[model samples]
Every structure is written in C-alpha cells, then in structure tokens.
Target chain A: MTEPTLQSDLNSFDLKAFLTEYGRLVVAAMEKRIARYPEESRVTQAMRHSLFAGGKRLRPILCMTSAEAVGGNKDHVMDVAAALEFIHTYSLIHDDLPALDDDDYRRGTPTCHKAFDEATAILAGDGLLTSAFEILSHAADDGLLPAEKVLTIIAGISHAAGCNGMILGQMLDIEGEHESLTREELEDIHNNKTGAMIEVSVFSGAYLGGGTPEQIAALDVYAKNVGLAFQVIDDILNVIGDPKVMGKAVGTDAELGKSTYPALMGLDGAQDFAERLINKALQAIVSFDNKCDPLRSIATYILTRSR
Target chain B: MTEPTLQSDLNSFDLKAFLTEYGRLVVAAMEKRIARYPEESRVTQAMRHSLFAGGKRLRPILCMTSAEAVGGNKDHVMDVAAALEFIHTYSLIHDDLPALDDDDYRRGTPTCHKAFDEATAILAGDGLLTSAFEILSHAADDGLLPAEKVLTIIAGISHAAGCNGMILGQMLDIEGEHESLTREELEDIHNNKTGAMIEVSVFSGAYLGGGTPEQIAALDVYAKNVGLAFQVIDDILNVIGDPKVMGKAVGTDAELGKSTYPALMGLDGAQDFAERLINKALQAIVSFDNKCDPLRSIATYILTRSR
Candidate 1:
C-alpha cells in the first residue's frame, strides 16, 4: 500500500476538539457513577487519586468516537465508554505497583502505590477492576441497550482484559525483562498487552452503537493496526521525545533494557513502519464516509503524538 | 425471636456427605474452566496452586444447595458456583501478598507469592479476577438462562464483590490491624468482607435456579446470618482449635492485635453469639421442605466444627 500524506487532514480535523467533546462527557459520567461507591473511605480516595491524575482519556474517547462512526448517538454508550477508561485506569494502577513495574510517578504525579500505602494501592486497583464489571453489568442494563448487547460487551472487555489478553501479556513482559526478544516476540507481547483492549474498545462502541457486523469487522482491522502503531510511537518517543511534553522521564525504556520496535527496527525503520501501519488502517475504513472522520483523524493522531 | 434446637436436624443430615458431593462438582468445574486459560504458563500455575489448596468449598456448596432448595437443578448453577470460588481464591491470593497479610503459608501450603514470585502471584490474582467475569458473561449466555437473568446475576455478583462489598471490607480489615476495633466496627468489616460474598453466592444460585423473589429473599436472610456465624466460629477456632485440624498456627489474630468477636466479646460470649446466629439462620428458611436439609446441616456444622 502507498503511504498517505496527512498534513492537510491533520490541520483540518481538530483532534483537540474531538477529544474534549467526548472527554467532558466521560469525566462527568465517571464522577456521577463513582459517587455511588465512595462511602467516604480511603479506598475511594485512593481510587480517585489515580483516576483523576490528568489522564488523556484516550480509551474512552476511542469508544465514543467509534460509536459516532456508526451514525449512533455517542452519549448512549457513555457508560460503556466510562467503563473502558475504568478498565484502563485499573490496569495502570496495578501496573505501577511495587511488585509490578514499580513506577514511582505517572502523568507527573505519584503512582497509586507511591501516593497511598502499598496495600491500599493494591485494593484501589482491585476496586477499579471489579468496578468496571459492576458499571457494565449495572449501568448498561438500565434499558439503554438490550441485555444481549450488554453481555456481549461485558464478555468482550473481560476477555480483552483477562488472562487471554492483557494479563498474559503482562506475564510475558515480566518474564522478558533482562532478556532479548525477537521482533515477532515483541509484537506478540504488544498485540496482547495493548492491541486487544484497543480493538475491543472500538468493537464495543460500534456494537453498542448498532453498527453492522461488517462495519465492526472493518473497524477491527483499523483498530488492530492503529493500536500497534501507537505502541511503536510510544517506544520511539520514549527514546527521542522531549521530557516536558511526555510527562515523565525519557529513555526509561532503554534504561530498563526493554525490547521495543525501535530496538529491533531502528528509529527511522520504526517510524516508517508506523506510517505503513497507519496507511493500512486508514485504507480499511475508507468506505465509512465523513461519519468516520474522527476515527480517521485519531489514526493519524496516534501516529503523530509526542507522548 | 426464639432459639430453635438443631440437634435433631444435625443428627439426621450428614454434613460431610453434602460437602463431599458438591465439593466434587466444584472441583471438576474449576478444573475444566481453569484449563481454558492455562497455556502452560507460570501465572496459570500460580493461580492453580492457590486455587487447589483445598479450602472447605463452603461458598460453592452454599450456592449449589441454594439452587437445590429452590427446586432447580443444581448443575445449572455449577459454572457460577465455580466463579464464586475463583473470586474467593483470588481474594485469598491477594490477601496473602507481602504488602497485605504477608503470610507465607495458607491452608498448610505456601501462599501464591511464596510458591511463585511476587509479580507472578499478583498477576495470577489479577488473572483469576478477570477470568471470573469472563466465565460468567461468556459461558452463562449459552441458552441455559435468559439474557436478563444472566445480567442480573452478574450485576449482583459485581455489587457484592466490588467496593460496595468485599474490597471495602478488606480495606477496613487492614486498617483494623494493630488497632483496637469495637464490636460494631468489627462486625461491619466481617459483614462486608465475608457476609456480602456469601449472601450473593446464595442469591446467585437461587436466582439462576429460577427461585421466586420471596424464596431468594428468605435465602438472603439465611445466608447473611449463617455467613456471620461462620466467621464467628472461625474466630473461636483460631483461639482454641487443634493445630492438626486447623492446618496453621492458632492465635495469629491475637498476635496481629487484630480485633475479632472473641477479642471484643469473651470466648464464651462469642460462642453464644455464633449459636444465636446459626439458630436465626435456620429459622429464616424454616418454611422450606426437606430440600433445605443440607442448608440446615451446614449452619449447624458451622457452629459446632472444631476448625
């Protein structure tokens, strides 16, 4: 496939506005829903500390945008969008625990375990994970969607976030520490670690928004390519991006000796590879028309992001 | 309002036989379901290590028995029965982590973190947590139950297991350690920690088994009362039970300065309280016929067991 130039589309489609419009709805939903469980306790406080730590709200926006791509009201699937972010936030909390990645800070703030006691951080992660299912099963069943659709969404997210996907990837990533991995092996890890959730988020949005199966399938191809490209850019930016914009130190991936696309393909090779992936992702959904512009724009944004 | 004698029912029904019958089913279900995620990985091994450590399987049995009491086929709820145990096992693994309870041993075997590395154990716990929901949404939708029933059960389980229930209880329990807690405070922790899951286990079984609303409500009362009695008996056993039977050191609760019924109320007082609780649990289900004999027997067994 020929690589597509993105300078015009990037300038025309205001990615900031798209993110802000969906992000505001998600934040409001999270606040209103989270109030049901706060109970004025420390666990809720810890959950909120990590949750509101200025995340870019990328996953929920993807969900909402995918819904809109299907010519459905994005607000109808807002709860599920919020749920995707909850699942993401929970993974972040656990990933930053002392026993896992041992991250001291996230988004320029102390990580969950660093901000709270280790035990509380662990529970905060557990709480958020369980709450994701709670919100999906509870809020999604309030007559907005059919029960079958809700169950399908629940099953999808659970599978994407479970041992069959993210958890297995995490296990493999931990085992890969201090060891060299082939490009294929690194891709396998990233596909499970990152690609599965992203693909499911898009799938959920389309399905909940009443898209045809063929549409979801095409978006599936779109999501898979863009998700992996997003990870590649993350690795490249880690090595070469400005620290202030990234919200944390740079070159930490190299410091940890982690395997990455750049490590296997070189910086220029990785960037060219990411461009190729984005071009293919865009081609997969070319038939969707202006309704899918945000998805198309998001694909470009993922390729060009600094952080 | 009146204490009911259970000596006749306890003598008539064989608690050991009841446990063995349902325990065999749960073990088989766990073996079959857990196999789906094995992939021959260490995380799966760690999950199995903690899962098969041979706890009493009280929760699963309660679930099965409640289904039977409601005149539904017990096997229909077997997958959910297994899900309850998975949720329980994951909690035990997390509770035993170094940053939490920090116990090296559980049920006379090395804890998950001790048997494997800390990161693997944590991931194993996470894997099991996510897997429980996967099994529910994926397997429960296979034409056995209606989508509404399946969603209702999932919502109930999530509510009972989320911040509204088990996680909140765990947080309070940790904070209660090394500090004194009143009787009300201690009961609050046990209610959330132990009572919520137990009550929901019975509720899920009854609901899945097609019980009437009144029947499920009655069982909920029975479950709540029996659940507390079970924990009170646990406290009593910790202080005075034989180590050979209990399979771990006794009096550890006292060692940790943790508050318990026996610490707040005297040993004799706690025993009396447990007896009262069991009697009330039995009374709640008095209208049921011989189908509830196992439930009656289990309540008596909880109060009178040596361990």
Candidate 2:
C-alpha cells in the first residue's frame, strides 16, 4: 500500500484539545462498559473510583489515534481502546495496594485500596481486568469487530499485561527497590512493565483499523519509542512535578531507592533521552500522512507534559 | 441425537482410579501450560507454588468429563480445562492474601504470599489470571477450538469469574463478616461466589464439546446443584475433618465468625441439605446415561469425601 502524504501540520496541532475531545469520548465508552452494580457494590465502586479518577486516558486515545492514523475508522477500535484503559486502570489499582507501592493517592483521588480496603481493592482490580477481556471479546458479539480480530486483540492485551509483560515489569520494579539497577536493567523493566502494554495498545488499534503488515510494523516502532519515552517522562515528572498537579507525592521513587531514568541518566540527561525518544517515535510514523498528526502531537506532548 | 446407554456403573466404577488417571493427565497439561520462566523467576515461582500445591483438580476433570459425556473430543477441551485451573489457582492465591483470608497454608503447603513476598503473591495472582485468558484466546491459534467458540467460552468464564460473579461473591463475603447474614443472603453469596465459576466451568466444557442445547441446559442445573453441594460439604468438613487430612486449618471459618451451612442449619441439617443438592444435581443429568456417572459420582463423593 502506498503511504499517504502528511496533511496536518504539527505546529498547528492542539494536543490538549485533541486529548480533551477524544479523552471524553473514551471515558464515556468506559462508563458504559463499566456499569455500576446495584446496591452500591463496593467492588464496582472501587473500580469506578480509579477508572473515573481523571487521568488523561492516554492509552485509549493512543489506540484510537493509531487506528485513525492508518485511515481506519476510530469507532471500530473504541472497544479495544476502552479495554486498554481498563487494563491500565487495573494495574494502577494493584500498584497502589498496601503490599505494593502503598501510595494512598492517585489521579487526585484516594487509591482504590485506600478508598475501600485492600481486599475490595484487589477484587476491584481483578474485576476490571476480567471485565476488560469481556469487553474485548464482546466486540465480536456486538459486531464491532470480527471474532478472529477480537481474539487477536485479546491475546495481545493479555500477553502485554500478563506475567511476561507488565507483571514481569512490576516484579522487577519491586525487586529494584532492594538494590541499584543498571541502565539496561531499568530499561528492561520499563520495556516489559510499561512498554509492552503501550505497544500492544498501539498496534492492536492499527490491526483493528485493518492496517497493512508494513504499517503495523511501523507502528510497532512508533509504539516502543513512545512507550519508553512515556516512562522516562514519568520519571522526570517524579523529580520535578508539583504534588498538587501530579496528584501524588514526588520523589517517592528516590525516597524508596527505586531505580528510575532520572536516577540513572541524571535529570538533564533523562530529559534529553525523552526528547530523542519522541523524535524517534515521530520518525517511525512520518511515512503516514497528516492523519498521523494526533500520534505525532501525542508523542511530542508525552515529552513535554508536566503531569 | 439419541441418548447413549449407560456404559459405566456407579457401584462398580472406581472413582479413585478415575480421578487418579484423568487427574494426572490434567495436572501434566497444567504443568505444560504453566512453564516456569528462566533464571528462577519469582513471579512464575509464586504462580507454580500454588498451582502445584495439589488441589483435587476436580474442575478440570469435570470439564473433560463434560466433554466426554457429550460425545465430543476431550482433547479439544483441554485448553479450556487448563484455563479454568489457572483461574482457580489465581483466586486461591488472592484469597489467601493477608488483606483477605490471611491463611498461611493452602493445600498442605505455604500460601503464595507466605512462600514469596505479598507483592510477589499479588503479581503472581495477577499474572495467572492474565495468563488464563492468554491461554483461552490461544485456543484458536492452536487449532484446538474455533475462534467463535473460544470467544464464547472466554465471555462465559470471564463473566462467571469477574465482578458480577466470583468478585461480587467475595465482596458479599467480606461484608458478611461484619454482620449476621440471613440464610438466603448466605445462599446468594454462595451461588455467585462459589457457584458462578463452577457453573461456567461445566457449561463451558459442554459448549466446547458441542453439547446440544438441551444437554447444555441440563449441565447448568447439574453444575449449580453440585457447586452448592461442594460448598456445603466444605462447611461440614471444616467442622469435622482433621486438619492434617484436610490440608488446611479446620474451624477457621467459625473462628473468623463467618457463616457456613452448618452455622445456619446445624450439622445434620447441613448434611441433609448437601445430600439433597447432590441428589438434585444427579437428577438433572440422570437421563445422560452412565457416561455421566463420573459427574454423579463426583457429586456423591463431594458428600462422602474426608477432605
């Protein structure tokens, strides 16, 4: 397939407006996907607490944008997009558990476990994770996607979030607390822990949009670069982000002796690394037309965002 | 289709031998499905810890038996069976967490949290849970089942084990600890908590085996009845069984001030209730011929087993 020439100019693209508009749509989809159970069910309550806890819906938006970038319909990818958000939300819930990061706050609200006890929080996370597959699988049932495609999407997300992916990353993150980690070790953790899901989220959307093998392969490059850049920016934010804006304590990573990009690369070096990663991400998608503006702008935003 | 004639006699059928043969096969499949990651991976270690801790393997066996009873190939259903065990194992890991049931021992060995750290235990459970779906969705990839059927099975199992099912039951269970529960309330808890996954396990097997709609409906009744009977018997065993044989502490439920069948119905009444449930379960599948003898015998054994 011939690549479409770029149409939207990066300089004029409003990243905040794109995020706000698409983020609301993703949240609405998630709200419908996550219905409140009757009788004020604590599990549902806890799930919704974090799910609606006002983060930038970056993963789902990235998914939708990836679909759009390939000239595929975004509507066709919404369920998968929402599924990505659910998986991300679940990870956050579990990460905040008393036995894990033990953070009491997230996205300007109390963490699920902090809000509704650890057991309920755990169940809430489990519920969201299970429901995510249910939602993705339902794409076929709803005639939103083919059964085979839905299965593919399910496999991608599950593997990305499963033991060898995000969970593996988490295990390393926990272990990293005990001792110093080399830059390679930290990158490995970021790749598996954060990068896998982010990569899957991007490519799954492209696949849903019926992107060609070449386009999908290109998106893989774009997603890896963007995913690593996202985490590096997060580490940078941990060092300089305002507590009020970030909605959690800063320097907790340093306080806990956790290895981070900033710690390993130094703050200025980490900032430069994030900039390079974003440029690499943009370069990966440059073959696509101006339709890639959302993705390009999002990559740039990831490097520049304060919270 | 005409129902097949009785091929096995309950009185003459050796339940132990059947369990032994099929159970070993199921365990081997589970072991293969749950390969350990290299370099003594702690997450996989914790997952293997509880996975191999030696439960009865009744769920997977029931899945296989249900396949056979429907004249479908049991080999076609093994992936789903392994997935069921993964889900069950994940639940056991999370349920034993210190923030939850807080038991140190499960299946005659240290719980995942006790064997590994609590954080590792949490990720291990999360990993196993994610892997279950990964394995289920892989059914199509392996040519073990059709993508559509696998999708249906995924939906059924995810829903049955998700918030509205097992997680919902757990929430109710936690709340139950705070107050005296009515018998009906307790039953509702048991049905969702214990019965949902059990019910889905049976029906998923039937679906995988290509059971007729009538047969599938019949198995639903069998599953629900058997599931409740299993729990009722669990309560009875807690009161009467030796801790060494039972492989976990007895009377811990009473110690925790949790309600049980015996607590609500007295020992004799609870035993009678279990007998009735099993009888009901048997009656539901009585027309299926002797091929169902494994299921019927399993229900009977639920009442009679020491552990």
Candidate 3:
C-alpha cells in the first residue's frame, strides 16, 4: 500500500472543534448513563469525577470516524464509543494512583485520589472498569448491535484491558521505574500499555462497522503504527512541549526516571521514527477512498500536534 | 415455605468431606493456572502466591451444588464456578493490600503484597479480576452454554461484582473504619461485599441449569440469608472462635476499630442472629426436593462449623 498524499495541511484539521462539539455531547451522555448507578454513592461520584474530566475524546472520535468511514451510523456506535472512553479514563485513574505512577495532576485537575481519598480513587477505577463492560452489555441487550458482534466486541475489549495486555504492561511499567530498560523493553511496555487499547478502539469500530476481514486486518496494521506514533510523540512532548498544552507536569519522565523513546533513541532519532510510523499508518489506509480522509488526517495529526 | 428440617441430625451430613475433596482440586487447578504467568516474574508470582494459598473453596462448591440440585452437570458449571472463585480471590487480594484492609495474613500465609510488594499485589488483583470475565467469555465460546445464557451469566456476574455490589460494599467498609456503625450500616456493607457475589453464584448455576423463574427467585432468597449468616458467623468467630481452625488472625476487627456484628451485638447475641439467618436460609430452599439437601446441610454447616 502506498502512503496517501495529503491534500490539505495537518494544521488545517480542526481537532479542537471536532472534540468540543461532538465529543462533549458524547462524553456527557456517557457520564449521565454511568451516574445512573443507583444512589449517588461515593464510588460512583469518584468515577464520574475522573470520567467526566474534560479532555480530547480521541478514542471515541476514532470509533465514530471508523464507523463513518465504513458507512455505519455514527449514532449507532455512540454508546460503544463512550464505553471506550470509560476504559481509557479508568486506566488513567489507576495509572496515576499512589501505588502506580503517584501523579498529583491529570487533565489540569488534581488526580482522582488527590481529589478524593486513595481508597475512593481505587474503587472509582474499579467502578469505571466494570462499568465499561456494563455499558457494552446493556447496549447489546438494547439491540445497539447484534449479539454475536457484541460478544466479539466485549471479548476483544476485555482482552485488551486484561492481563495479557494493559495489566501486563502496567506491571512492566512499575517494575521498569528507576531501572535502565532496553529498547525492546520500552517497546513492549508502550505497545501493550497504550498500543493494545488504541488498537482495540480502531479494530472494534471496524468490526462493528462490518468491515471485511481484509479491511479489518489492514486497520490493525494502521492502528499499531498510529498507536506507537502516538506514544513516541507523547514521550517527545514530555520533554519539550508546554505544560499548558499538555495539561500535565513537564519533565515527569525525567523526574520519574522513566525509560522513554526519546531517552533511548535521542530526540532527533525519535522524531524520525515517529514520522516513519505515521507514514506507515497513512500507507495502511490506502485501500479506502476519500471516506478514509479523516483516518489519514488522524495519523498525521498524531505527529503534528504538540500535545 | 416450611422450615427445612435438618437431615435427621447435624452429624448425618458431612460437609467437611465434600468441601475437602472438591476444594483441593479447585485450588490445585487455580494454582496451576496462576503459576502459568511465570514464577521468575515476581509480580505474577506474588499474585499466584496469594491466589493459590489454600482456602476452602466454599463459594465454588455452593455453585456446584446449586447446579447439581437443579439437575445440571457439574463439569458444565466448572468454568462458571472457577469464575466465581476468581472474583472472590481478586477481592481478597485487593482487600489485603495496605491501601485497603491492610491485613498481613490470609489463609495462614503472608498476604500478596507482604509476600512480594505493593505494586505487584495491586497488579495481581487487577489481573485476577479481569481474568474472571476472560474465563467466562472463553467458556461461552467453547460451548459450555448457549450465547444468550452466557451473556446472562456474564451480565449477572458483572453486576454483582461491580459498583452496585462488591465495590460499593468495599467503599462503605473502608469509610466505616474507626467510626461507630449501626447494625444496618454493617449489614449493608456485608450484603454488597459478600452477599451480592454469593447470590450470583447460586443464580449462575440455576440459570445455567435452565431453572424456572420461580426457582431462581427462591434461590435468590436462599442466597441472601446464607450470605448474611456467613458474615455474622465470621464476626462472631472473630470474637470467640479458635484462630487455628479459622486459619487467620482473629480479633483484628477490634484492634483495627472496624465495625462488626459482634461489636454492635454481644458475642451471644451475634450467635443467635446467625442461627436465625441460618434458619431463614433453610426456609428459602424448603420447596426444593432432596436434591437440594446439600445446600440445606451447607447452610447448617456454615453456622455450626468452627471455620
């Protein structure tokens, strides 16, 4: 597959507008549905605080874009899209906990535990994680998707979030702290920790969109490249990007002694590597027509944006 | 429903033999599966250590008996039974962590974190929790049950394990620490933390056994009674029972200033309360034929046994 040539500049894409308009509605709906968990218990409230915290709903947007790219209804995919956001948000909450990364801030606000108690933060993470499947199961029962497809989506999401993927990555991340990590070690951690879920976002949407096996296979490749590129850029930004734009403490990697891509590959080499992966991502989407433009734009956008 | 007359006498039923044999096999299987995560890896090994440490497989046995009482195959329910165990084990791992109950010993061995480290213990809990759903999903695909039935079981299990149930109970339990809790407050915590999952076990087997709605409703009542009885007895044991048979430190409740039934009600009063709930549990299952005798016997066993 050849890389798709860009018709418009990356700066022309209005991600802020896309996220603010459609993303806000999607996230609000998600928070409302999740908040319906009986009485407004402390656990539920903590989960809502982290989940509804404002951010670019990139995962959900990817779900919607993948659905639209395949001529599926954006509205039909909305619940599943929101579910993806919950999973992402929950991971972030747990990752920031004292037992984990011990971060004080997330998305420009005090972390969940900082806002609440450590125990509340833990339960909040558990609540969000479980609620993701709850949302999917409820949507399946409501006929948002076919039972078989819903089963597939549920299984896929669980695998991505579970031991063989995200949890395993997290274990490695915790173990890797303050220790020198090999290049391969860094790749494994980021690939599973971040890449697996991102891949699930794109692949689940594609599968639910009724993409052909070949198309789904192609999207997997695209997703892996884009996921890695996303992380590489994140590492680069950690060192050089403005804290105002990132909404997180700058130089956290340096302070934490984290093994990041830029630390291992150097800034220039990491930039080149990200560009190559972005090119590969763009190339993977070449089988589609103009409908795939947004996907192509997203790949470029991953590297072009400062945050 | 009439009160279930104890089979001739208490000695006529031998729960020890039943639990001993099946519990051993269940623990062995669980240990083997957990060990597969790699012993060289300290994190996975810590999870395995706590998970595999010997404990009575009472919950899974309850599941198996319920399936058998409804004339379902025990082998068919193994996956569901294991899933039940996984959820229970995950709860224990999390509860024992320093951030939660901070217990040093569980099942006569060092807790997961005490055996390894805090971060490993956390990941282990997360891994086990996710594995429960993974096991259930795989069981469904392997033709253990129909897709619809599998979805029902998964939905039920998730609901019991999620915010409305176990997590909420845990949150309440944590909040209740060092505070004077009323009887109602203690009951609410146990009902969700312990009762919800116990109810799920019975419901899972019955649903898989193709039980009628009426039967399911009856079993739900039965489960609620036994679940409360189990906790009440636990509280009583903490006050007066032998720690050797209990296999863990006792009287820690008072030391930690945690609320308990025995703390609110005297030891004798707690025992009386437990007996009343045991009778109530038996009443709930009176409509079932002799096939349910094991469940009735188990209910009696719960209140009378040293453990």
Candidate 4:
C-alpha cells in the first residue's frame, strides 16, 4: 500500500488549521462539562485539572470528524466527543498513579497525583471515568439522535472501556513490564490499551450518524489501522522526537526496558510499519465520499505530527 | 421511637436459609462469568480469587428481598442483584490493595494482592467494576425488563459508584484515618461508602418491579435507615462481636483508631441511635401492604445480626 505523501496532504487541506479548530471546540466542551461538577470537593478540582490540561484532543476530534464525515452535525457529536475525551483522560490519570506508571510529568504538567495527592488522583480518575458514561447516557437529551441509537452508542462505549478492552490492555501492560515481550505480545498490549477506545471513537460516531452496517464495518477497519499507526508513531517518537515537542520525558521506554516498535524493529523499520498502517487506514476510507478527506488527512497527520 | 424486639421481628425468618441460598447463587454466577476469561493470565486468576472468596452475599440478598417486597419475581432482579454484588466485591478488592487498605485477609481468605500481586489485584478490581455495567446493559437479553429501565438503572448505579458517592466515601475514609471525626463527619463517610449502594439496591429493584412513585419514595426512606443501621451494627461488631463469626479480624477499627458510630457515641448511645433509625425505617414502610413484611423484618434484623 502506497502511503499518501504528507506534503501533498498538507497542501490539500490545512491539517493544522482543521485540527486546531476542532481541537479547540473539543477541549472547550470537555472542560465545560467537567467543570459542571460541584466545586466543593478538592477531588473534583483535581479531576478538572487533569482533564483540561493541554493535550491535543485527538480522540474526541476523531469522533467529531467521523460524525461530520458521515454527514452528521458536528454539534450533535460534541457531548459524545467530550465523553470520549473523559474516558481518555481517566485512563491517563489512572495510568500515572503510583501503582501504575508513577510518572510525575504528563503533557509538560505534573501528573494528577503529583499535582494533588494519590488518593485524590485515584478518585479523580474514578470521577472522570464515571462521568464519561453519565455524559453518554444524557446525550439523548440533545435530541440530535434517537434514544435507541444513543443506547447502542453507550453500549459500545461501555464495551470498549470494560474488561474485554482497555482495562485488559492495562492489565497486560502491567504484567509485561518485568517480562520480555515478543512482537505479538507488544501488539496485543497496544491493541487493547489504545486500540479499543480509538475504535470506539469512530464506531460510536458512525452509530450516532446512522451509518449502515457496511459503513460501520469499514470504519472499524479504518479505526484499527489508525489506532495501531498512532501507537507505532508514539513508540517511534519516544525514541527520536524532540523533548520540547513531545512534552514529557522521551526515551523512557528504553530506560524502563519496555518493549517498543523501534526495539522490535529498528527505527527505520518502525517508521515503515507506521507508514504501511497509515496507507491501510486511508484505503479503508476509499468507499466514502470526499467528506472523508478530513479522515484521510488525519491518518496522514498521524504519521507526520511532531507531537 | 421504640425499636421492635429482635425475637418478635426476625426470630422466625430463617436468616441462615436466606444467606446460604443467595450466597451460593451469587458466587456461582460471578465465578462462571469471570472464569470465561483466559485462566492463563495471572490477573484473570487474581480477579477470580478476589471475586469468589467467601463473603456474606449481603447486598444481593438485600436486592432480592427488595424485589420480593414489591411482589416482583426473584429472577426478575437477579441480574441487577448480581451486578450490585459485583460492584461491592470490586470495591472490596480495590480497597484491600496495598495502596488502599493493605489488608492481608478478607473473609478469612487471602486478600487479592496477597493471593495474586498488587498490580493484578488493581486490574482485577478494574475489570470487575467495568463488568458490572456490562452485565446491567446485557440484562436486556434476559427478557425480565424493558431496555429503557435497564438503561436508567445503569445510570443510577453509575452515579452511586462514581465520585459523588461510594468513591467519595472511600476518599474520605482514607483521609479520616489520622484525624478525629465529628459525628456529622462520620455520617457523611458512611453514607457515601455503604449507604449509597444500599440505597441504589432498593431503587433498582423498585424500578424493575414496577414500583409506584409513592412506593419508591417509601423504599428510599426505608433504605436510608437500614443502610446507616447496617453500618452502626458493623461498628459495634468490630468492637464486641466474635471474630470467628465475622470471618476477618475484629477490633482493628479501634487499633487503627478509625471513627465509628460506637467510637463517637459510646455503646449505649449507638444502640439508642440504631433503635431510632430502625423505627424510622419501619415508619417509612407503614404505607405498604403485608408484602412489605420482609423489608420491615430486614430493617429490624440490621440491629440484631451478630456478623
């Protein structure tokens, strides 16, 4: 599969401009909704800090972009998109706890536990996680979609967040930490940890947008490819990207002896693998109309982004 | 507000029969569902141990009794009942972790982290928590209730388990460990920790049983009283009850200098308080028919149980 040239894709659509606009809307909505929690508790404040801290709202953007590609209103997808961001944020907060990653820095800011206390950080993660489903269940009040479809979307979100997916991924990641991992072992970890929620972002939008079975199926393929590509790029960035651009400490993967795409395959080979996956993602979107150009550009952006 | 005599209220209710029957069913169903995951993974096995370890299936029994009080089928409430147990069990597993309670025993069996590892116990708790919602969503296939009600029940369960409720209680409990707590402060902690889920169990069963607004209102009051009384009894038992019956260490509450109703109110004052709450619980059920006898008896039983 031939990958789309990043230069040409950037020229066709201002990738940064689109992401920036969508990213602003996504982050603003997430922050506003999270802030709606009563401000009395220190835990809620800590949760808001972790949630609103500056990171590219990539998951929510993917959700909104997919909805727009399917001709659904972007406004209709805002709450759902925010809900995706909540799930993503919750995962990060939990992952950074002392029992988990024990990282002090994330996105150039102190992690939730470092900024607050460990117990507060744990509760903050729990708050964000439960709030994600709460937001999804209430999406029907927006009147942008039918109640049944909203339920289906919630179910999809629940499944992705549940034991069969992201939680399982975290479990495997913990287990694999002290043990050496094979290529297949590493793939399985990334697939659950990152791939599950990423897939849900697109499929949930497709469901809300009233896509047919075939479109939903096609979007799943696209989501899986992009998800894997996203992780591969992350692994590569950890090894070679500028610390200023990447935000957090880089090369920690090698320091921790964690398995990575570049570790299994050399840096050049890992880049090739990411490029191949990006092409596959693009191919999955071929049946869609030109509205899907954003999706294609985003896939290319996955490979080309500095952060 | 005179309390009903224990012999008059629960002497004939056969508590052993209820506990044994419901306990077996709850454990079997939970074990079967958890075992569906690959056993080779240490985390999955750890999750199973935490889930299956011998504990009184008190929450599910409360749910079943609540369903019966409304003249609803026992099987009708089984899924949600099981779900409540799962949530309770997951919280216990997480609470027993080194980062949390750091207990080595639960119900006379090894704590999850002791039986497995700390990381596996964490993931196991995560898996179980997420699976509770999954089980509720899939309850539609059981044909006992409409999907919409199931969704509403899920929403309520999420709210209780999330930050404002049980998790909040946990945060407060941890914070209270080194501090002197006022009576109001202790009430807030107990309300969020145990009372939230206890309240939800009644509401969930009522929702499924086609309870009227008045019945639901009445049950809410009934639940509040029993939930608190349940905690008061637990506190008393910690100081004076037989450890053989309680299954885990007793007096550890005082050893840890934890706040409790008895600790703050004194034994006689706590007893008076329990009587007052039990009377309030009975008053709430005065509007119900003879079908409410089981609910009334259970409230009385809260004061009389040794373990």
Q: List ranges where model 3 is wrong by over 4 Å.
A: A1-13, B1-13, B28-40
Q: Please identify model 1 stretches exceeding 4 Å from their true place.
A: A1-11, B1-8
Count the clashes in each prediction.
0, 5, 0, 0
Predicted structure 1: lDDT: 0.86
Error of 3 at A187 (Å): 1.0
Could you give the candidate ranking by DockQ, starting with the highest?
1, 2, 3, 4
Candidate 2 or 3, higher DockQ?
Answer: 2
lDDT tens digits, residues B100-148, model 3? Answer: 8788888878888888877777777777777777667666676667766
DockQ of 1: 0.76
Q: Rank the candidates by lDDT, best first.
A: 2, 1, 4, 3
Off by over 4 Å in 2: A1-9, B1-9, B36-39
Question: Can you list each candidate's DockQ?
Answer: 0.76, 0.74, 0.58, 0.49
Best by the lDDT measure: 2
**Considering every candidate listed, which one attains the maximal DockQ?**
1
TM-scores of chain A, one for each prediction: 0.95, 0.95, 0.93, 0.95
After TM-score superposition, what is the CA distance of residue A143 in candidate 1 from its true location, in Å?
1.3
Error of 2 at A122 (Å): 1.0
| lDDT of candidates 1 onward, in order | 0.86, 0.87, 0.80, 0.80
Per-residue lDDT for A27 in model 3? 75
